[model samples]
Target chain A: MSQVLTIDGKDLAFDSGDTLFDVAQAQGIYIPHLCHHPDYPPQGNCKLCTVDVDGQSKCACTTQAETGMSVQTDSTTLTEYRRALTELLFSEGNHHCPGCERSGNCQLQATAYAQGMTYSSFKLLNPQRQIDASHPSVLLDRDRCILCGLCVRASAQEGKHIFTIAGRGSDSTLAVNSDSGLLADTNLSAEDRATQVCPVGALMVKQQGFRIPIGQRIYDQGTIDDLGNRRPQYHSPKSKTARIAGDSDD
Target chain B: MTESTTDSRSLTRVAIDPLTRVEGHGKVTLLLDENQVVQQARLHIVEFRGFERFIQGRPYWELPMVVQRLCGICPVSHHLAAGKAIDMLVGAEQLPPTAEKTRRLLHFAQVLQSHALHFFHLSSPDLLFGFSSKASERNIVGLLEKHPETALKGVKLRKFGQQLIETITGKRVHGSLVVPGGINKALKPAEINVYAKQMDEIIQWSTEALELAQGLYQADRKHADFGAIGSPTLSLCGNNGNFELYHGDLRVKDIDGTILLDHISNRDYLAHIEEEVKSWSYMKFPFLKRLGKDRGWYRVGPLARVLNCQQMDTPLAERARLELVNQCYPDQHQSVLLYHWARMIELLHCAESIQQVLKDSELTGGELVAPHGDRNPECYGIIEAPRGTLIHHYKVNDQDLVEEANLIVSTTSNNQAMNEAIRSVCRQYIDGHGVSEGLLNHIEVAVRAFDPCLSCATHALGKMPLSVEILSVAGHETQVLERTSQGEIQQRFYPC
Candidate 1:
């Protein structure tokens, strides 16, 4: 009924269909991740969740759990590689934590904190990007986007189909699937799952900024390791009907 | 000091642009005549943030959060005002009793914190230390160094208010607690008990603070008249003619204490009041309709509120107000410096109200939020912010997306009054030969008396720091006074 896998020298059991990420999360083992929500299908776009399995580097989110597999999660090599990936993600966007409203709540920022990234090693790519406030309720800050496509995937899952990637590689950008290319034209409400799925501050709900006082945000309450339960409820299927704790204030 | 040469070229101008020790950015410009007489003075709001234009196309429900970004210092005022507006848009005028009580408590906390900040952090430095003390010494640091115990009490008092905000709204700067029809979360018994305990200390500290402020005021009666000027007053009062901050009808009164306009609905503010936009400043000057622009310019904030209201609801504040009016001043205290006394009185009222609200068990009721109802096309929300009356108007489409938005913030209402006060102070103190730091401080005292929020008035984009300059003629720069990052005033004489 269940299979065993040795992760970081600890034996853990998994079901036949469970991905390596599911097994680690179920076993209370944290493999730093971004672009990998439990409710959504596994996507390996972000290579930050990579782990050494049987002497081969595999993405924990997309890779299926196998029997008797020796996985090295927190090894020095893996830690260094994950740090570089997080650093690369940081460099690719303007991730100014102090200025960003989503600093404490952001999964990317939380993952970077978990990876012990005190500082970014890569050169800063301070790309000049447009902040689209045309939508009224939501602000589309392209500068904060890391191209994870979480909003796109979440919207498609909800049958909204309002978000999509429009280009290839570095040129690829998140585009609203509307003729006007603005959120106002779409039927996106403030309570949409797509609005909650942003790993960064890219798709922010306006006026909700700076509401959560500093020194008492998600990270301030507990480390990411202990704050897994407090993540944005985009992963919950009933999120549409479920009243978000802070959503009502806006 | 030697008399300056009487020539247009020799005349000097003093500018305190990006005024320090207050929220947001504003500047005071004084022009001296050829005879060394002060000709004119103006307070210019230099920043403009077009939030009304940019908020179009947003869902009406998001307005509370969207508008609160206008000023960091008074986000709660905007947040609650926007929340009230959205409540009207959603057709929920009579909110649940529990929700009403909760919002009332939140409003009290906001007033307490804002007043604490204004009195302790911003104004107390000038009051505690002599106004003409060293630029570096007449600040919070100086207060901390000289009066550490008093400074600590102020800090703790401000913290208590912020802590109350955090307890209710979940954060202080821009708490996302209040919604369209009601608040997001219900108060827990544990949270209520904690605040109830803390209120005792807060009340005690506030009482002592009132006593201290009165003593300070009495110490320098002459200096208190630095910015005193005669102006008509406009404020909001409760339905029963009682002092009100959260909800009220707009009322206007003349300089001689005669009621000009009475019991006007806030929704019809545009019909009763008009804004005159001047080319020299970004802030629009608001004046009453019947009196017209020339005589209609009126003062707001504590001075106006105290003068217009018949009674205060709280006992401690009522006694304080009676004592203040009967002994220290007349029925309508026109002196700008009395604002400090009125502010302290209101602070005491807020503290007592906090206690009164916390004791009520209805605050912990189960109904935390109201169900969404049919939407309206347009609505207006008005509330008395800490500085003065604030108004937010929004028009929405059938889909509930914001089509147009307009805001007449607290500081904007006092723009003409502030300019008039500055003109009066300049004429009284400045006698050419440029201006001394002491006189400039006196000029700043006039503007500070209103406790203006230039950021909310101008709604400017990005951060603005304070700086002052003195110019001769049109093109020639003479002197500059800039606020360093440490908030100390730095003097620089520019080569002509």
Candidate 2:
């Protein structure tokens, strides 16, 4: 039941119900992604992972892998598109990479580096953003948020429903689920998946800033191309049956 | 905390503004009588970071990380001190044994690297070359050019310490590993084994450094009398009266080596010490409550810690201390210049302590953190940072949002004493005539002995202008020299 597809003129095989992102990841090909964690349901909000499939532009995260479907991941047009997307993200927020604690490890920053983006192409829109520090174990700096909705999806999957997206277009913003609109008012702990899911510096675990020194962070060692093949260390909990099966072997 | 006395009708002011060779922005203003005798000397902090005001809305857990941004040199000090304070808020009476040992090891590494930086990089340039050495030949570059091997050794030693910090906490400058209750990760067996293997090398380098410092001092007797002045010493020591750099109870010793106050809890620092604000400086002067302002002012740092401690924790440092106190300088090692010697002794202690902590088998213990309950409203965290005692106090609400904060850093603790030391040096050197470059350098050397970190002390952030002014007898400026750009220092000569 295996089928082959061509990606960037290279033949790759995948089973049924496989998305382009899943196939690419399995083939050790990095398509520069955020808002599409392997463990969480795909949101396809960020267009950084868009690929040209059969002469049509489509988000690889939302597209299904088809037999003999030709896909282009790297090209002059695609490179410019991803580069522009990275620039837009940088310009929309106050992303002072030098001052940010997550500068070295941030997915947006790493993706930009992977695309050879030396500087932003668009004018920086340094909007005044509110920093929500009402939580005991987390700090929410909206200024650095790219509004990918990973936290919103990750927390919802954990049944906490701690985050949501409000408004539309340029006015859209991240919203808290609790009545008090503070993390301390909820049962959120430092170990929550939501706290660990933010790919940016927007949602940071307090007291852990700069714990890892510069030039030694995960992304600092190598490009995402090298690290993209490895499976994520953290993932969603196993099902009840899977857990029982795993325990029997132990 | 002396006034500038600009209003004085008949006083000549010699202003060594934009003092060089220290951490951050500062100026020394000396008021002179008609005979040019020093009337008063004041050290002014020109910048303020306002960290306390901005941290208000930040969560209590973020305090440890946010406070560290206050200083790049001693970020680990603020990091650990804030962690301890937040630990109180989290209701952890004591951290897990493994967590405590890991923190101790991290702190020792920090101390080792910081002391190495202050000695080999900051102060040793003046000591190895001369206080009056040409400005062109009085920097790290000059040290590299003159004594390449020694400078390399210092760099290697600092790298060893910094690597340990990165290995344990995962970052060199501001790593976010220590949580309120405990450290996020335990020291791996492999990490400990590696550090344990390097212990002998660290010890040897530190021993050689101590010898070099002693040699430098003996070669130049003039340095001893350069900025020599005695004042009350203040520090925090363990219950056993041993030298403590990480955590301890506040202790004050008179200049004559008598314990004036002991065993005062850190929670009551505000009750025992009060800050006096001057109009000319953003920095505050901290004085003991038992004595009035003039008598209560005390000096803190390696000099105070060396003279006040009953004994060092490690055997090598203790032996070094005995030699310095009894064999080298019998008069209790009071000279400001001798602070370099005290710093070297501490460096040895840190190296030895690192070995001891790493050798402990409990370092690889499985328990990394303790259980912390609901948050409290307020708490205080205090520790002996590389500079001296640092205190972080915060008030928070039920949601863990900070409402108010107060920080008392080490350099601020020595503000009054620094001014007095500058006055003493000026009295010994400067006259009615304008200061020569050498005279200005001597004053800087006196300040450098304390290894003052004014950036953290003032908590001021943003662009700061540097200026030096010469005032006439009527307080009118005769000449004003301001640094036009940051890079201007490289082109400008220190000695004119």
Of the candidates shown, which would achieve the greatest DockQ relative to the real structure? 2
| Model 2 agreement with the true structure over B1-496: per-residue lDDT tens digits | 2445545667767676565322556778877777766677877788777889977876675677778887777788888998888888878748888888888888889888988877887778888887767555666667889999888889888899899988876678777666667776777788788889989999999999998987898787676676676677888898999999877888888877788888988678888899988788888998988897877888888778877788997998998887776633345336677778888998999999999988888887757656776666678888888877889988887656788899988888888777777877877887655456566667777777775454222211111234456677655666555433331222122321
Given the true complex, what DockQ would model 1 score? 0.15
True interface contacts reproduced by each model, as a fraction?
A: 0.05, 0.23
Docking level for model 2: incorrect
Backbone collision count in every prediction? Answer: 6, 13
DockQ comparisons of all candidates to the true complex = 0.15, 0.21
Q: Kindly give the stretch of ten consecutive residues in candidate 2 chain B with the minimal lDDT sum.
A: B455-464
- Per-residue lDDT tens digits for candidate 2, residues A1-250, read 7999999889999999999988988877788776777777777898888999999988998899999999998788988898999899999998877546676677788888988899997999887777777775677888888898988887888898999988899777888878887776777665677777787888876645544435456676777656651211221211000010110000
Best by TM-score: 2
